[model samples]
Target: MHIGVPRESDPGQRLVAATPQTVEKLVALGYDVVVETGAGADASIPDDGYVAAGATIGDTDAVWGCDVVVKVDAPTVSEVARMHADATIVARMSPDDDPALVEAMRAAGVIALNLNSVPRISRAQALDVLSTMSNVSGYRGIIEAAEAYAGMFGGQVTAAGSTPPARVFVIGAGVAGLAALGAAGSLGATVRAYDVRSDVAEQIESMGATYVRVDAAAQESADGYASELSDEQEAATQRVYAAESAAADVVVTTALIRGKAPITITAEMVAAMRPGSVIVDLAASGGGNCELTVPGEKIVTENGVTIIGYTDLPGRMPKHTSQLYGTNIVNLMKLLTPGKDGQVVLDLDDVVQRGITVTRAGELLWPPPPVQVSVAPPAPASAPAPAEPAPAVEQKARKGTGVLVAGALTALLVVAAVAFSTASFASHLTVFALAVVVGFYVVTGVTHSLHTPLMAQTNAISGIILVGSLLQIGSTDTVVTVLAVVAATFASINIFGGFSVASRMLAMFRKEA
Candidate 1:
């Protein structure tokens, strides 16, 4: 099958559907790739780059005429009408309940895959355009905030005085929210984040931000996305929001619901901030999380607070964002072209592919079969009851038995030293006895669940012992020499065995596993 990459006609778009790096991947999969001349120019990619990557640079007609047409935005109806029947067009088509585009796809008999529709399941994460773009937007939000703010993000300690770090409050702990909070924290800013889902609190804290606790967000997210809060709950949350926003030096909002972002920062909250403070609204395209945000514009409040409402945060950093988005396309291509034989196969049985497919077989297939986004956690096993404590008399008897065994061993060692041992031999036996007792206590203290970690620690100890014993191998005393040899042999075995077990334990943590 032939794949085509056309130049984006939209003036505001700086991203390309495919880049030089991704074109190479498509060609490696046995597909002839065609790119429109200067398609990647906005992203700082030259036409020669695509050509060097095994893509043919061609005119608009030549590129769009391929069997599969890939794009960043949804192609217009006129553009879709230009494609030949049975050809496939793939893009991040946020149809937004548009019937015209679906009707056009049906009439043209073209296969349309909307990257925005990619499932939220773990297996489909690579193909998810929303989260991928949102991550870039989140990081870019912090940069824009820093640029507009008067003071530094990080606190400074100079000979003159000490400066406190700027406090950042982020609303919504999703991909964008986490990224914003992390970026802010990395810049030495104090960060705080809040989410309607309580489960994300740990994630927020892991990013070096405090999770603002709210009692009203007692909701479970079964679809990998936060569920809508009730009106009463939202009001309860707004009450807490006022306090958080008031204390923040820079505020970022990323909450979205049904394509509309509800207001979390009111005008009163903006008025409470200091004169030089800034607010970056990442959800501006979705009506904004700030009630004062003007979409696609930056404005300063009368009180000297800056409110930024940028719809193109991802476009601000085009080079890397293009690469990431292009790679997502390549991954989707890899899934569709399983055989690497230049054939496109639409396997509806696969959830990832089916979820992105909007129109196929001369019919509109928007809203594919519903998939369960969240995996149901397995039921935990019932724990066994605790063992009852032994009687006081029984415990005392066991302790007495241990003391007797110790006394007998000490007597035997003393008799051996007095009857047949030299001073040198006695010193060696004393060291050996101490080693045995310490090793026994250390090994016995470890629980079964911690055996692997214990092995890791013991491995280092064995290495030291092996080196020390090797140094003592030339001792004149035969007993000392033999004991040294035995220690070295056992320590060698432990070193190798411990490494093997440790490697297996690390393999269990690999991302693929």
Candidate 2:
């Protein structure tokens, strides 16, 4: 098999399909590697590096003629038209719900393996192109903000006085938002983040960023992605959003609702922002989070604020991004490839194959799962079958059994108390024995009378009293008295603690009933 890495044709896509390292891996796997001239240049891999990795460096025409054409973006129609009928084109084709691109891949007779369509399974982590790019896109979002904001992130001490640190407000506590927060916070900026998932607030706080939350109807999908908010909820969040956005020197918005364009950032909200503030819209790829954002362009607000809508943040850091994404691509391909003995094989029965294989055997083989329909519940059963009541005689017997056990435990405790009172450490031991007996009685009483708390308080009071008695006992026997006091305190605490535990158990029984 032959694999080709082509130069990206997408306007802002700076990523290369395969780096030299990945080319080497493909070569080891029994595939001839061809890379278009300057294919990995944007990603910091020179043409010489491909040659050193045993890959042939060729022009675009030669590269496109291979058995497989790998790319960072979907190939243009013209490019597809040029491809060999049976060739496979591997790339990221998101919102694959689009029929035109789906039909084109079929007509071209080139198998399209969309990297973005991979699932978030544990075994697929290395093959998750979406997660790979997202990790980089997340990091770059903050670096872009730092560049756009004129002021330094960290505080400075000048001849005049000290200046406070810059403030960063990040919306959406997803991978991108958290990365932005981390970058800003590392530079000593006061970072605050908000998300529709209130459950993630603890994570945000753990990362040293303050979590900002507003009261609104929260909706989360089964996959844990934020669901689109209703109009009322959106309106309710605006004022709080505006206040936080207005105060921050930098704001990074990463909220995205899967297939939809990001929720619009209203003009009123933009107006509230201070002049010179910087906003990096990670959601710009899908419309934008800001009202005035132009995808892949930076727009200056009427108030002189900079709203950056650059969509391909991960592309800007292609070296590491390609390394991460290529590993994902290789892992995915390996899963699809067949092998024998010490070799790899594709299991068609695997959920991964069914989920990501968009088309097979010249047909659209992939479709989203059917939506679950709610069925009207059956009416309550008329005259529900009567449950057999527990026998009254058995209930009485169990009560008697409990009482018998309590009495045996009490008798054992009494014997121990007698032994304790006559022991050499009598004075201190007597108090502890009395306290233990009282504690057991209170716990076994079947009800939490005033004696429960009273027993606990008395246990503590006995400890203090023991110490006072020891002090009066003086030096000749002071050490002995102190030892007795320590023993008494330990025994009393254990006794009272057991009673408290019993009270808790009884509460559970009541609640269950």
Candidate 3:
């Protein structure tokens, strides 16, 4: 079988259907791969690399000759007219009431697989083009917001003064919203997020951001998308929005309504916001959520709020986005024909393939795609296995014994070193080092028995600071009068304090189980 890849026609669409690695995989599977000249150039896959991977470079005419045609975007009518009668085509063909494209596929007699129609299931994750694109869109949305907002994100407290962190509000909790939350949080801002689905509130909070709740958002759509709020709900929502808007330094809106113009944020809402605030509308391409939002433009309201409504946010970082989208296409291609050795295999019984296939057997499939079914993964086992206590207990016992022995040896060494020094501070240094060894051993033993990270860090900090001070001041000689103070300051922190910490930790095993 032969597979073909043509250069995508969509403007700013840099992703190629097949990468050099995918071509290599196809060749290993026994299929001949052909790519249009310069098809993957934007993705950094050189022509020589594709050739090395056993793929042949060809003109558009040569690509249209293959049994299977792959692409990143929906094929145009002219491109579809060039396909062979029985060729299989796979790409992100949106089936949202596009009767014209559906009819065109029917006329061409092509087996059209809409990759965007993948079910939201564990098995479909590897082949999900929407999620792949959403991930890129989400990441890019934050970066653009950060660039537009001219203030720093994180709070800084120094001797001079402290600057309060920027307050970031994200108006969706889907993939893009979550990514925005993380990116904003990493910049040290006080981030808050909201979603129509209450289930994701905990997830937002877990990422160290506050979850803003609005009672009016309970009306979610059947497909789990947020529905447009009723007039009454919208009014109430604006009240809450006014408060948050006044406080927020940056607001990123990622709300969407599948197959419809997005819900609008009124001019009144923008006017309510503080001056110099930034609002990034992620659903700008599908009509924006903000009245001030102009598709592909950044507009500042009369009062001073910046509303950014740029379409194709993912295309801003084309290299990484292409890599991800290309990988998704490769995965689906491999799954559909694992045994074809690069040949075409039309398996109609497969659930995913059947669901997304728009045309097959010289007829257009009825009820054009987005077929849903419960395809969730099996729930993980709730409980973990009971762990064996013997090994853990024995390890603790051994550690206790070592600690006791090391502590005893350290105590003896400290006494001997101080006795020979015969300085006025020798006694004080010996006493302090011994005390540190004892304290460290006790804290470590307690923490080891408990197995708590917080406790361990607490004890570790205590030991380092205490023993360090003692080591620097403990040792001195009788003849060295003036230099004795310097020696005490340096040597006490280095020798006594350092050794005491080591000795105490090792002394844990010296105790009986």
Query: What lDDT tens digits, residue by residue, belong to model 2 across residues 250-365?
Result: 98888888645565467777888899899888888888888888899998988988999998788788888887777776776677565512133435577665556565436666
Q: Which candidate is the best by TM-score?
A: 1
Q: How high a TM-score does candidate 1 get?
A: 0.76
Using lDDT, give the best candidate's number.
1
Q: Write the per-residue lDDT of candidate 3 for residues 1-513, one digit (tens) a residue.
A: 788989988757777887787787777777788999999887777889889989999999899888888888898888889988888888888766577887888898888988877766567789888778777777788788788887878898999999999999888888888888888898899998877767778788767888888776655454446667777767766676667777889888877777444554678778877888899888787788777789899988899888888877777776667667768877777787768566667676776777678887579774544444433433579867668667878999999999999999998987788778867468556556576676577556652323345546655555544454444443354344334455445644543454566577668747556
True lDDT of residue 203, candidate 2: 76
Q: Poorest 10 consecutive residues of model 1 by lDDT?
A: 442-451
Collision count for each candidate, in order: 1, 1, 28
Per-residue lDDT of 356 in model 2: 64
User: What's each prediction's TM-score?
Assistant: 0.76, 0.70, 0.69
Mind giving the per-residue lDDT tens digits that candidate 1 earns over 1-513? 889999998989999988888999999999999999889999999999999999999998987789999998899898887899999999978665677988898889999999988878887888888998899999999999999989889999999999899999999988899989989988999999999988888788766788999888856566567778898888988887898888888999999875688888999888988898899999999989888999999999999999999999998888989889999998998899999887899998998888888888688777888778766863568867669999999999999999999999999978877679787777666665566556566555544433555674785577556755775689887886898899899998997786587678878968673
